[model samples]
Target: MGQLFESVVMAVKAIFQNKTRAFLTMLGIIIGILSVSLMGTAISGIDQVFEKSIESMGQDVLYVEKFPWFMMNDDWWEYRNRPNIEEEYAQQILDRSSTIAFASPSSSRRADVKYGTQAVEAVEINGTTWQEAFITSVKLESGRFFSELEDRYGTRVAVIGYDIKKNLFPDEDPLGNYIMINGNKFRVIGVIAEQGKFLGLMSMDNIVTVPLKAMKSVFGRLRRISISVRPKEGYTVDQAKEELTFIMRGLRKLKPREADNFAINQQEAFRQQFSNIRFAISAVGLGITALSLIVGGIGIMNIMFVSVRERTKEIGIRKAVGAKKSIILFQFLSEAIIISLIGGIIGILITVALVGVVQKFFVAQLSFSLVLISLSVAVLTGIISGIVPANQAARLNPIDAIRYE
Candidate 1:
């Protein structure tokens, strides 16, 4: 332990004697560690944002549509030609399936909404059944969701989103107030709780919802619709999906050999797609980071070689005084490791500061695992870079190195 401590002290002294060269040697390592840590933070932030967006869509809900969310076999035309899913299927599923707790058909269109003089343009207007409240995790900030009777009788009651309420009814309570959608007058019955951005791109709070019947009356029923279904409390998702598929196949009247035309999608589908994207991003990011680390390692190796050459006479004198080769090797190797560790610490500090700045635009997280990973990479790089130079120094002949002018 004492010998190791002495070697470390010698390494520090050597490094301090040539502070400028040591700093230059550490520069590459600093940049490499910074790049890797920042990349990790960005990926973690993206994942968190995606998870929040997915949570808005209930985990237990399944979406039944004419086309699948992900392309299968590059067959775009095949899905495009599929028949449009209709609102009637939602009722059929509810009536026929025992495993389904709730089912609702939903469709969307972009339109301008107005209350008196205040107007919000290009707002998403969703047409869905009252059961949609059960199928999704929609919470109300104020007022109440539309009743089943209103949905059945095609009442002109509407539920507004957070942004709509903010823009249209800045001061006054939105409940009991009539809003104009396109040209028709609809009473606002509820206001959805604030839901931030979806995938950090589109605002989830900029939407308005009304009864399916009312939407069809206003916008026509030719547009495609999707059914949202939730499994009963006692049943699993797979069981619900199985029951739903059987009923759908029966409703569509597919023959024994004929394939079903509809698609059943779940929250996992979105998670899988996001996971693939994240994996790709990680691969590319790590690849680039590896390149930077490689360059940094090469720099360290080159500098170590120059250091060994300059200290040849010093090494010879130490050997003549009976200094072991292992001690000499440890001394140089310790210097390299210490330099890398310093760079790693600086890089981590910079990353923490940058993460705070990045959080203003998007969520960026830095965890202890990332800190350990950066430091480990630095240590490994130092060891690998110092091996050849340390070996050369240890193997130098005492007489020849002492005589070197």
Candidate 2:
């Protein structure tokens, strides 16, 4: 321990003697560490964004649609030719399935929404039954969801999202007020809680939902509809999916050898797709980071060699004074390690600052694990890059080194 401390002090003195050169030598390491930290922060932010988006869909809900959510290489025409999933399937599933706790049919389109003089364009308008309140995890911020009777009678009662409420009724209570959609006036019965954005791509809170029958009456039955189903409290997601598939296949009258025309999608589909994309991003990012680190390691090795050459006479003097080769090796190695560690610390500080700025717009998280990993990489790089040069310095013949011109 005493020897190690002495070597560290010598390394520090050596670094202080050539501060500018040491900083220049560490430049490569700094850049490499910075790149890796930023990459990790971005990946973590994307994961957080994805998790938030997926939460809006609910973990237990299953979506039954005409087309699969994930289509890999399969011709679009194959899905295009498949039969459209009808809204009636929601009722059918509810009637036949014992595992399902709730089911609702949903359809959406973009239209201008108006309340008196205030208007918002291209707002998402959803058509769904009252059961949507149960199928989805969306909570009401104010007022109440439309009743079953309202849905059955095709009442023009509408439930608005947070953004819609903010834009249309920024100053007044939205409940009991009428909003215009496609030239038809509909009474607002409820306001959905703030849902934020979906994967930072689209606003989930800029929507208005009404009864399916009311939507068909106003917009016609031309738009495609999907069925959302949720399992009962005791049932598992897989069991629910199995039962739903059986019921859907029976409804479509598919033969034993024929594939079902409809697709059953769930949160796992999105999770799996996100995982694949995250894996690809991480793989590519790691490759680039590895290249940078390798370059940095090479730079360290080159600089260490130069350092050894310059200090050959000093090494000979220490050897002549009876210094052990191991001490000489440890001194050079400590210098290299200290330089890398300094670079790593600077990189971490920069990353933290960058993450702070990014968090205002995105969701970057600078985790402790990432910090530990980065510092460990920097230390390991130092040890590996310093080995050959340190050995060369240690093995130098005292007479030749002292006499070196």
Candidate 3:
């Protein structure tokens, strides 16, 4: 322990004596650590962002659609050939499925929504029943959702999203105010609370929802419609999916051997698709980043060799003064380690500052585990770099080394 402490002290002195050279030698290590840490932080941030987006879509809900969310080697034409998903399937699912809580039939179209010329272009106008509010996550910032009577009568009542509220009526209360769509005036009955982006890409807040009956009146009933079903409490998503499959099969009158036409999709699909995406990203990112560490290690080795040559006479002096070969070996090893470790620290600090600046816009968190890993790798790099030069120094003949001017 004493010898190690003494070696560290000597290493510190040596580092301070040639500060500029030491920093230049450590530059590679700094860059390497920066690359590695940045990659880890970026991947972690993406994971967090994905989780939030999926949560917004409602974890318990299953989407019954003609096409699957992810298309993996499956033919799009095959899916297209499958029968269209029916709006009546929602009530049928509710009646027949034991695992289902409630099912809401929903359909959408892109339209320009105007509130006295403050228009939002291409905003998604969703049409669903009053039970739609019960089947999914729909927290209101203002008024209540439309009642069953309102939906049944095709009342021109609408619920708007936060972005629509902001763009259309920034300063006024939107509740009971009339918004025009296709020259038809619909009263705003509720405003949905601000839900952040979907998958960090599209806004969840650019929407206007009305009763399905009212939508059929304006847009007609020819477009695609899908059901969003949630599982009953105490039942797993797998059980709900199984029940949905059976019900759909029975309803469609598929034989024991006939393949079902509809896709039973959930958040797990996103998880699966993202797993592949994450794997691809890590494979490419880590491969490129690892090269930096290797180059840094090589640079450390070359500098340590030069350092050993410069301090040859000092090694001889120490040997003549009763210093053991192990002490001489540990001294250079400690110096090399300190250099790389300091470089790693600097790199980490810079990464932390950079991530902090951008985290508000996106996700970029520097975890403690990543910090430890970077430091550990830096120390390991120093050990590997120092050993050869350290061994050469330890084996030097005292008289020969001292005389080699």
Q: What's the true lDDT of residue 376 in model 2?
A: 89
Cα TM-score per model: 0.91, 0.94, 0.91
What is the Cα-based TM-score of model 2?
Answer: 0.94
Question: What are the per-residue Cα lDDT tens digits for candidate 2 across 268-322?
Answer: 9888999998888788778877887788788888988999999999999989998
Listed per model in order, the count of residue pairs whose N, CA or C atoms clash below 3 Å is 0, 0, 0
- Residue range 1-405, candidate 3, lDDT tens digits: 997899999998998998998888888888888877887888898899899898878878899989889975668888889899998898888988888888888899999999997888998999998988877777899998999999889999999999999999999999999999877899999999998888777899999999999988978873778889888899988999998999999989999998878898888999998988888878866775577667777877888888889999889999999889999999998888999899899889989998998787787899999999989988998898888888888899999888766
Give per-residue lDDT, candidate 1, residue 258.
83
Task: Please say which candidate is ahead in lDDT: 1 or 2.
Answer: 1
Q: Lowest summed lDDT over 10 consecutive residues: which window, candidate 3?
A: 284-293
How does residue 390 of candidate 1 score in lDDT? 88
| Candidate 1 off by > 4 Å | 1-28, 321-323
lDDT of 3 at 357: 88
lDDT of 1 by residue, 1-405 (tens): 788899899989998998899888888888889988988988988989999999999988999998888877778788888888977888888899899999899999999999999999999999998999988998999888888999999899999999999999999999999999989999999999999998877899999999989998888864769899999999999999999999999998989898878899998899899989989888887887788778888888898899999999999998898878999899889888888888788889999999999888787899899999999999999999988898899999999998877
Q: Predictions ranked by TM-score, top down?
A: 2, 1, 3
C-alpha lDDT of residue 48 in model 1: 90
CA RMSD per model (angstroms): 2.4, 2.0, 2.5
